[model samples]
Target: MAKNSGRSRTGRGASTEPARKPLWRRIVRGVLVWGAALSLLGAIFLGTAVFFTMRELPDYTTLMKSQTGQMIVVRDRDGRELVSLGPSYGKWLSYADIPPIMAKALVSVEDRRFYDHPGIDALGLARAVYVSLTTDRRARATSTITQQLARNIFLNNSRSWTRKAREAVLALALERKFGKDQILELYLNKVYFGGGAYGVDAASRKFFGHPGTELSTAEAAIIAGLVKAPSNYSPTADVEAAIGRGRVVLGLMVRENVISQSEADEIDFSKVTVAKEKGQDSVRYFTDWALPQLDMLLPENKEPIEVWTTLDRRMQDAATKAIDGNAPKGTQGALVSLDRDGAVLAMVGGTDYVNSNYNRATSALRQPGSAWKLFVYLAALEAGYKPDDRVVDEPVTIDGWSPKNDGRNFAGEIDVRTAFAYSKNTIAAQLGNEVGFGTVAAMARRFGITTQINTKPAMVLGTSEVRLVDMTRAFAAVSAGGTSVEPYGILKVTTTSGELLYEHKSAQGQVLVPRYVAAGITDLLQTAVATGTGRAAQIGRPVAGKTGTTSSNKDGWFLGFSSGITTGVWMGRDDARPVGGLSGGHAPARAFAQYMRVAVARRPVEPFDTELKLPDWQLEPDDEQLQGEPGEYSYYDENGNLVHPDGVPGQDELPRYEDGSVGPGPGPGGVPPGVPIAPDYGPPGAAPPAANRELLDRATGRSVDDPGLRPGQGAVIPVPRVTPIPRATLRPPAGQQP
Candidate 1:
């Protein structure tokens, strides 16, 4: 019994020992799994680093050779570049090619340990990390100059973790592939210096009007400051801020031992001379207008080429000064100056492009108002109406609608010149009807009114929308002796390397009006400027123009042409609401006068084309011959069909003459007994017509110019109120004519 008890105790102990074994084995397995996971993670990290390091950087040669870039170069008429555009695809240069002070300033501002590190410094990384975590910004990460260059050249400027990783990898790769000098050269050459200038060479030339190697310490420091934000630090872009930034750069140069402390301190950054040509050509107006022309120049590839335009730099500067200095408060203005051939010389779309890019000179379309009257008078002249012809300005109504003059009253009698000089709406409306509204509209289109023109009779009163550029171009046609030419800004385009790829010569189309007629029109417009609405536009030279003001005076425009240039100025609120009391002859005219004063200062005073001298009669249309009842042309009604109401016979019939003796007018049934009476042709309900059957027969084929026919001759045509045919009247109440 003792032996059996001992054996059972041993088996129990053995079974209990298995629990300890299981605990130890589980611990060992857990440790092994953890170790394997750690090894795999380490491999992944190493593999990632290796992959990035092995990736090749983008080649600089290829970047320059690629055809998907733009380099906009703006030049003056004298072929001096006002500015150059260099956003991408720019060349690379060496640090030595840049001013030494600039090199030191960049190192001082960006990477203080640039020369010490291969690509990135560990200390910088740590500091950057701490700053990033605290400041909540990605730029807190410190990238050496080499690393920054690598990122700029090979990686995008995205502030992301993936991009960061790639940037580090590329930086390391760049250090490994290139020598320190080569890396510095690439960075200097590839860095952007803002204001559309790229690379050390281009930037140096842009900012200093000289080579990079020759920049002074102050200028070099300013250029260095541009590395962070070129637009923000450009002296021309932000003078005070750029100067302040330059001081910071100079301070860094002192700390970096680039220059003596005294030299850095003595640097007179207070008056850091801003490079005149550093900023763009102030060609905001031309830039907008020349875009479409550029598209044609480079139709195949979208690569932007440098354009050399006919812009006069001095003139552009004068224009900017004039517009900014004299523009009235609370009012916006636009000025466009194009040469006689339609080459834009200077254009200021607004007083300032930085305030708003909404180009008022080219984009805004306001009512031409009286400026459109030029076409009105031009059409009248074309239709055999003389400038000296007499037209009564009494109250006139066309189909129950009466148009008022500017002040709602008419002058009794005035020649066409006087009527036009005073802008008599009644007389102009009369002339429009005589010439036909469609004829005036067609003439307007020919003279460059691209928008829809109202063919309604009110169109004679200048109620149509037209863009400033189109208006300028149309007026330019007048200045160019009636030969219409497309307005152009770019005269030539060349590659940055001096390849003449495109050139624009003068493009002329058909003669819109006869040369003598053009001369006559010019003379009349000159008269307008000298003594009438455009008197304010009178410079020392002969000028021709018209002023336009919409109803309630919301928008005002003055468009004029000198012997050498044509300019258009418009002033208005953006909302198109009524300004209520302004006249086109006032503000817009003053602006024109201001701009022209500056323009004529440099130009030689020249008279208009005197070769086409006019005999007194040549300027006026002939009045001896009748202009053929002013032919009532067919026009579509709302339904788009032709109808002549006066020609169509209604159901009402005439009374039978009864052996050619007069009798009471017939009724609707056409009998002499119980003749139906017609209403009188006076005030709403005064007429008691005896169904005047004789009136209808007498009105048949009556010429509008028939002298014997008095007012209210033709029967009122019952068609829509499109034409101004007079209402029918009874035969002077029975015996006045006999």
Candidate 2:
């Protein structure tokens, strides 16, 4: 009692329990305790989430099947791999087959604890965070090999915290479900090394030009370096940077004891070879354009399919070379080539596919300038206007907008053929008005052009945006003698096991124009190529095509067909900026020449069924010698048979020649030179029309469209005699004029 009293008067005895803290401190303690409890609950919740996520995670089999389903391998007509739609891979390499040095290099540079971690790499991650903060070593500081594999196999290549969390959780699941060796093998076989290459095999072949089985240690080191930044460290993109990264990998290998320091030092990285850069890989453009069609051809989520396409490597390579060699700086080009049946043989969408993958051939909708004239002229011909008919090319205005010729003076009373050859905008505008702009748009649709076409007068000058492929197909219709065709790419699709999925069946073409109409258009195209803006595209053969230049020279095009191969070329800046001095008759035409020069030699396209003939007095007046004695002459072919552009010639009232040969006069194939004639002849052995009735134009000697007609009456409208070709020719020029 005395001792207690001696203590401070505040207390008699010491309390057995600890002293009470102040209110603020107690509140802080309570908060800390609650925080700890919540953290524990969060941990339990995370574990449960991991349990469910693991359940949902794809197994090895599912991973492989999903990848297989996404992959679409394309083969050219000759069965060589052209391009791949999804992740491209070579033969799969097992962990044992993977160079032991390759594994060590990746593990050393990517995750030192790869062999020991449960895929999450808790300690390695901590060290990595510490090293990233404290050191200057620029290496792969996050994501273990297993994590990378998980992200690549199951998730999109997107960067986000959610993605990372999923990757971490999935990595643990991978370790829990799969053996370390199995995971390593998958990672080795499923990693992306850029340039459309996936897996060690594809990376090996793409980078070193060798099989993965034959990779050297230095080469392996280079591949390991790409895991951090595939595009940045691409061997093709930057060899020096790749080698420097490879050196880092080798140093890491030395630290990991995967290789002796002496061995690492002795490695000759200088001898490391990378694949030569193909100037421009344009083949991918075709594949990308055709990939969407693949989905329509195959079942959804189907196993890997082998696509046999109509792509011709020779033509494709030639197109690429031409575009790359001729396209001006900062400009791009697109080319589309088709057969008479409209099979797409070659398509070059841009100058450098790596720089831009937007397919201009099938997708870019640039103004065509005068190339749009194909439809306008066709519409006029269908409306009873002959190629030799007179068309005014003087200044014209429609809807308060006047269109002028490119030159100071206009060829005022030019023949339709002349106006077409020269691509006269005034004449085209006049013709568009005469036939109705709607009809011109209909004509384009008739020829398989599906792009939206403006019905305004400027549309005649190609002011309406159009695609290269669609225009190419439009020309293909004329080349096919009036039969319309749709451009096609994939010829066949099959599974790897030879299971046929889809096979192409060509449908009978729908005739969109009369054979005479086609010949008339052909005549115009041929003359343009020979003497007009398309002259630069001349292939020393009968080529029917035209040149188009847009306003401000923004887009230039040369689209034509010779010997059955129709090609369309477009050159311009992507932002619609002017390509200085570029014209359809210039770079685009030159490219056409370069491509066709090689294309014609590959196969024999039948000469157009109709031989090019001299213009009439109402035609080609230049051929004056064709005018024979002033008496009516009957028609005869080179074989001495009477025929017209798709009909049997009138034989009942034919006048006889002095030689008693009926129509053996001085003109070509026996027609009087002075007498006006029409070069309308059907292909040999062509079956007559369903009615089987035949008629001839008395005024022009052309096959009339009817079975009956009065004397002096004519098929279409009567026009003065002028020299003319079998096809329409003659036009006088200017924007998207040439």
Candidate 3:
């Protein structure tokens, strides 16, 4: 019993020594604790920096809203929408609302395996890394869909390694904060499509005129491929590339088992279904019309809004095609068709919407040339100049500013019909002076030519610059028979949910002129095609038009209309340089005629709503038919009155003497004395005198005086003497010479 107690005390004594740990374990524990604490602090710093950055960002909503302004939706008379103008963006829909096929196609084409990745695909990152290490190229971006969305909404199309890094970080954050579906939805809604489309939905409707859900398999594939590069796959811009991209999308679908391989392989690449884009800027023009209404609806920084218009796609297409075919080569053109009530039917800004977005028809202010004279003549008619009133076409000058006729010749006494038919500048100038430049300027403004008129006599000749919209609108007033209609681009603006925002109304007012007076002017203009300078504008239907050619051949314009449409065409270089020797009648009219031929092919024939009455004037005898009066009887002396047979008093009497002076006054062909004699210094009266002394001497090869002679002969020139100088003396007899 004593030994057992001793052993127990010994075991207790052995436990008194502490247990030893390995040096490596102690080092690991200390390192892990310190590393964890530092990581936490670094994360806190990063979070704080991110928070401050977010706080300093500009308000996106406010920034976008301040830009909403006057929007116009252009449409045809049939209420078919052509273009949307202003800050118009299409409706936004959630990714859940998007078709499954659309989503699959997009994912397959843009980023396959999107669902399997966390913001970024590890495989894609690895591939990018491998490429960067082995290849001589810059590193490829390894961004996810969320990253693209963030960049599109808040950044530029910058291509930098730093930007790529930011995108990756933002993408991870975005994915963690928002659901995958929400991220995709924002991405689809925030991209830009060609032709001013803002989102996939808007793009679908714009290219195909159908909703996103209604897209065909091929159409959907084409659109989905565009998200990667819109211009590269734009059907209008790069058709071949778009087809190639469409094929690539189809192949991806087959590869992903989204569609049967057989079906994908059997797909016809040759037959791509591209819906015809109606007018050039239909949606943009409509947006242009609707922005003002949107401003009034929610004037503050407005969210991207939707607007519906009454532009007809077919009419818009026709108008666009017509303008493209008619506008001069290398020259931009614009067309705006409107109803009598000032509602725009179709509008085309330029031939290629992708190349130029300047909207020349509404925005470019060019001189209207003779197109403005319609108003001047209208004013004259209102001032009581009848169609048959006599107006002299003699050369005239007004206030030191002379206006020449289109051609150099002047027609003696023409009636107003012929005068207006010829676009006689002298007659128009006289009318402007008679009716006052202020009156003509006021009349032009009333008819919608609202640009500044010089109020000089030249303004009557259309020297003032005006926009195509204004010039056509002024002619439209004549087309509508005097009730001026303001040219407008918008019909109505609305929200995505069909809430009415605003509507457009024509500008109201009248510059007093009776309907009959305006009709009379229209009648005169019709004759412009029938027989005048605008004859080339004659269409199959009864047409009325005016040809306008600016000085120096700088601008050529044709503004005309059938019973249905009034269109204006201006052909000139953008730099305002002169064109290749063209007149308004030849190039501009031919282009206008060619376009109208195609545009009006399907349109029904309609006549102007005015009575056709022939005036009591007959065609005057042509120059060839009018015999010139005998030259002897026609000319007069300096007084300008007709000369009598008794002749010009002692100045120009024939050498026949009534009392028979010196052999019948030297006969019929005689040269008499005091006939304003030319000097002859060849020995006084030598050989009936060589009047042109130097010329005769030169012709005969006779010895002539040479200045090089020894101080004896005058200077000898090879050519005839122009004028003789008085002989100089070294010492002048001053007073006597003076």
Every candidate's CA RMSD: 12.4, 13.6, 19.2
Q: Whole-model Cα lDDT per candidate?
A: 0.68, 0.77, 0.65
**How many clashes show up per model?**
7, 44, 38
Better of 1 and 3 by lDDT: 1
Could you tell me every candidate's TM-score relative to the true structure? 0.67, 0.61, 0.60
Ordered from best to worst TM-score, the candidate numbers read 1, 2, 3
Q: Name the regions of candidate 1 deviating beyond 4 angstroms.
A: 1-58, 63-73, 79-96, 104-142, 157-165, 192-198, 201-211, 218-286, 300-305, 316-329, 351-355, 407-414, 609-738
How does model 3 score by TM-score?
0.60
Residue 386 displacement in candidate 1 (angstroms): 3.3
Q: Model 1 clash pairs? A: 93-189, 386-621, 554-579, 678-689, 679-687, 680-687, 680-688
lDDT of 2 by residue, 523-639 (tens): 889889888878999877778899999888899999999988999999999899887898889999999999998888866655555433432212223322463322223345433
Best by TM-score: 1
